[model samples]
Target chain A: MIGTWTLFQRESRRFLRVKMQTIVAPALTAILYLIVFRYAMGDRQVPGLDVDYFSFLIPGLMMMAMLQNAFANTSSSMIVGKIMNVHVFLLMSPISAAEAVFAFLAAAVLRALVVGSVLLLVLLPFSDLSLAHIWMILFYGVCGSLIMGSLGLIGGMWSKTFDDMAMVNNFIIMPLTFLSGVFYSVSQLPPFWQAINAWNPFFYLIDGFRHGFIATGDSDPLQAMGAVAILTILAVLSAWYLWRIGWKLKE
Target chain B: MNALEINNLYKVYGNGNVALQDVSLLVPEGSFFALLGPNGAGKSTLINILADTVNASSGSVSLLGHDLFHERAWCKRRMGVVPQEIAFDPFFSPREVLKFSRGMYGQKADDAWVDELLERLELTQHAHKITRQLSGGMRRRLLVAQALVHRPKLVILDEPTAGVDVELRKRLWDFMRELNAAGTTILLTTHYLEEAEELCDQVAIIDQGKLITSRPMKELIREVASSSLCLRYAEPLQLSDEDKSILSAFSPRVYDNQLCLTLNKQDSRSDFDTVYQAAKQRFGTPVDVSIRQEDLEDVFLRLTGDSS
Candidate 1:
């Protein structure tokens, strides 16, 4: 635990010192999405959401920041280490796989929170958002970040070249998060699209996040929470298993 | 007890290339052991296995009586490694880099010791400079200082001096010797035979993923006593028919204004006397002869074949 905390602190220090890359960059992305989406659909209101389009977009924007920052934290960290050959520093240490996973995930989640909080604060002045259920917001936000962070770690570990990592981000992660009904409710979609969204784990993340904005959701909160719990467990398990095997790292 | 031992290690990559093949060796306690090999000879694989950065396909390794796999955590804490490549977080200063590395090893912060390492490696002046901006030699020194941050009992350096200039290489060697004298067993791999010959008491050679030979440096040197003799002639001495007939006996070659000979492995005393006598008779005056005793390079070439 001490070892994990030490690594976590080091990672935090690295990100903090380079705030433009870790904080300002992600916040800028959130602001861009806000300007574009708010202009395109500002006055429109969804049937069951009980808010303007910007309010709905705020949750999605927060979730986007959470996901992207989580992915960037681990992927950038590992890939940079691999490229610089400084990975030897970590590889030669006494830190175990468990400690490594803990450290990386912790740092990723922290970045997610920082970025998410900034988006929320910046958008708060422009909208009338109720603090309907802060607990649920925190829960799903943290869980969504963990899932993406763990996925980033798996991507970083399995990639031998930078191109492999870039491929994972562009081809898999981006498409899923964008098409997961972040802007509109899945209930309005046709049967085929709804079926696809049902299988998407990101759909559940946004659905759970939107739940915190209102008292109820189009889907059951319990179901989305269950999905997140299961995904988080799988991410932790896969990371732990990879570490034990020393998968790409050892050989 | 051996400070490090490997028995029948094997590593077959997923792509079906064999990286290590039935390799095994022992590093006795408190001795500087050099694992010498060619470019693709599995030196990195062997080192990675001990460091737990690479898993072996089969067999076992132990460090200070601790199993490398089963007791990996404890074994890891007892060893340090300086990898051949200079890997660093470019954004960090030398001090931050060392502090982070020390923390990763599960050690308490020792500012004085870390500062001393930076000082010894001649990096104290650049402690606050970001790593990416440092020159190649400074980067190499930073690698060495990072490896020693945790104060492990055994330190392994894999080609730590590959591209370093002569002055820095000598400083690295001196620091390594000091560590060895202080009872930190040093294990290294190098292409520089002179470095291995001068520093390592025990030497192991690997080729094509297999262990070629392991012996004391002195014994290996002594085993290859086909002394190299270079003769500078006053005028180019033409090889007479008689000299040509016996030339194969000495493995002679002529270049520019000199003749070089590698006497047969088991050259008879009479053979050397004959070559000297023939040279004098053919040239009508004795040539200036310089005899150099066999060294590790000779043994290395003999066992691995000469490329240089």
Candidate 2:
């Protein structure tokens, strides 16, 4: 337990030491999205939803920031450690593979929550959004971060270099987050696109998160919750399995 | 009890490279043991397996009687590894590195002990400096300090002095000798045969993934029964036919006015007297003469056949 906590603390300090890149940059990116999209859309109402476009977009943008930063936190750390050969420090220690997985997950989740809170606080005065259900907001924020963090761990473990990590972020993570209805509701898209969005796990994360703020979303709340739960479980289990097998970590 | 023991250890990589081939050895408690081998001879592979950085394909390892695979955590808590390559979080200070390492081993941070290590390694002034900014020798010292932070009973140093300067290497050996005197079992893998001969009590040599020899340092040195005699003359003297015939039997060679003769260890004294008499009668007494006995280098070269 002490080893796990020490690893978590060290990993957290690693990112927090570079707040400009890990926290502030993502927060600034979120705010920029809010300003640019709000002005372009001009107070229009989201189709089939009572809230205005900006209000609905706020939750999506916040969740997106959380998810992206969470993923970046773990993936960047892992890739850098691998490149620098610093992973030997952890490998030579008494920490178990399971403990190492948990430490990385905890650090990623912490960074995500920190970025999410900063984005929310920075955008609160500008937007007329209210937390309709605080518990739902907490649930979606944590579960959504967990999903991305776990993906980041898997990607980090599998990648051999910075370029490989970037490929995963650009091709896989970026496409999923953008097409998951962050800028526009899935209901506004064609039936074929909506069907595709229904299968994306990011869609549930965004829909569930937006449901927390506006009390309404494009998907069924219960089904979205189930999807989030299942994806989170699968992601966690896969990361743990990879860690235990020492894939790309040990020789 | 032995500090370390291995049985039929084998490591076959994914590409089918056999790094360790049924290697086994034992290091007695409180011994300064040396693992000497040529490059690609599986020295690093064996060290990595013990450090838990690499897994073995088949076999077993035990550290102080604890199974390395099954009781890994327990064994790890009692061992420290200083790897060949310098590995540290660049952003972290030396103090933080030590603190974090102590914590990783489930040991509470002891500022006094850490300070003592820093002082002993001559790193007190650079304790708070970012590791990336430290000089190479400083970084190497920090690596040593990090390994000793948890006070492990057994310490493994893999090429600890590979790139260090003479002064720093001497200091490191001094520190290591002190630690060994305090009862820490030290396991070292080095390419420097002189270092092993100077410091280690037990020596093991591996070649082509096989343990070629494992014995006490003196005993191993004694196995090679050859010595050399080097005689330097004050002036260059042309060898007479009689001198040539007398020296040719011992394979004597002349370089820079010095005649070198290789002799069997048992006949070295008599051979020296014979060579001295012949040289004196021919050259009217040389300027200086010295006898060089067979050291670890001769034994190592003979066993591994790696003269280069």
Candidate 3:
């Protein structure tokens, strides 16, 4: 247990040591996003909802930022370890593989939540944000980060270089988050696009989390909650299996 | 019981490189042992397997009476390895690295021990500085300290003084000797034959994924000494191509102006008389001749057949 805690503490401090790049940069990016969106849609109202555009947009942005940072934390930590060959220290320690997996996922989840809180506190004054279903908000906020963090662990284990990690972030994660109805309502899109969004796991994360703030979105909150929970289980399990098998970790 | 024991160890990497082939070794408890090998001779592979960073293809290792793989956690608690690569988290200070390593191995925080390690390693001034800010030698010393933080019973130093200055090397050895004197078993791997000869009581040399020899240093030197022969001429010797070619068949070498060769068999007096006749023709009367005791470098070259 001490080994696990030390691993977790070390990983957490690794990112926290670079607060300017890990925490502040993401929050700053979120504020810039808010400013641009607020000016671009001055008088727009979300479709079939009484809330203004920024109200509907803020929750999605916050969740997206949280998820992105969560993935980045684990992936970057792993790639740096591999490139520097410092991972041998962890491998040689008395900690078990299961403990290592848990430590990394826990640290990645913490980074996600920290980034989300900073984004929320920074953008609170600019947007009309209120918590309608606080329980749902907390649920999706944590589960979403876990899911992303698990994926990040997998990506980090598989990536051999920085460019490989970038490919995952740019080609896979960027498309999923953007198409998950972060900026606009999925109901306004054509039926074909709505079906595509339904298949995206990020849609469940974003739509379920947005439902917590406004209690309104293009999808039902209950179903999204169930879907996100299932995906969370799958993600965490995959990460654990990869770790146990030592895929790309042990030779 | 031996501090470490290996039986029929082998490692075929994912790329199908046979790094270790049926290699076996045993290191006695509380003894300073040296593992020597030529480049790409599987020294690092063997160490990595014991360190738990690389899995063996077919082998079993026992460390301090615990199975290295099946009971890895138990063994790891009592072992520390200073790897060949210089690796550290740039954001972390040396102090943090040491404390964190001890904690990772399930040891409680011991500030006194940590401070002592820092001071002994001459890293106290840079203890709080980021890893990149320190010099390469400092990082190497920090690696040594990091491995010793948990005070493992068996410590492996893999080329720990590769790039270190001579003064720092002396200091590192002094600290290591102190630990060894206090009952720590150190297994060191180095390319410097003199370093091994000067320090280690036991030595093992491997090459081409095979173990050539593993024995007590004094015993091996004595065995090589009996097989060594040197013929000295009356003057600074010069040999023609024909004469040198005939002497070459005797595995000849010139060391300290003396023609040196090893007597391979138990009965090589006939071979000795042949050398006397050949060298006597080329360089006049033999002034002095005696049995030449070979050093560690000669033994290594004779076994591995690697001149360079």
| Model 1 C-alpha lDDT versus the unseen true structure | 0.82
Q: What's the candidate order when arranged by decreasing TM-score? A: 3, 2, 1
lDDT of 1 by residue, A130-162 (tens): 668888888889899899989988898888889
Report the lDDT tens digits of candidate 2 across residue range B146-185. Answer: 8899999999999998778888799889999999999999
**In candidate 1, which residue pairs clash?**
A85-B87, A86-B87, A250-B53, A250-B54
Model 1 agreement with the true structure over B1-308: per-residue lDDT tens digits:
88988899899987899988998888999999999888888999888878767768899888999888888778888888888777778878999888888888788889999999998999999999999889988988888898899898899998899788999899889999999999999999998889899999999999889999987878877776568666888776555567656765665555556665665444435356666665566555545787766577766765664333
Off by over 4 Å in 2: B228-262, B265-291
Which pairs, if any, clash in model 3?
Answer: none
DockQ of each: 0.69, 0.70, 0.79
Candidate order by decreasing DockQ: 3, 2, 1
Across A1-251, the per-residue lDDT of candidate 2 in tens digits comes to 88999999998999899999888998888788888988899989988888899999888988888899889888888888888788887888999878988898899889988988888888889889989888888888888888788889889889998999999999999999988888887888999888877788888888888898989988877667777788788888898888887888998
**TM-score for each candidate, following the candidate numbering:** 0.89, 0.90, 0.92
Worst 10 residues of 3 chain A by lDDT: A119-128
Candidate whose TM-score is highest:
3
- Which TM-score values does chain B get in all models? 0.83, 0.81, 0.85
| Candidate with maximal lDDT | 3
Specify the CAPRI tier of model 2.
Answer: medium
lDDT of each: 0.82, 0.86, 0.87
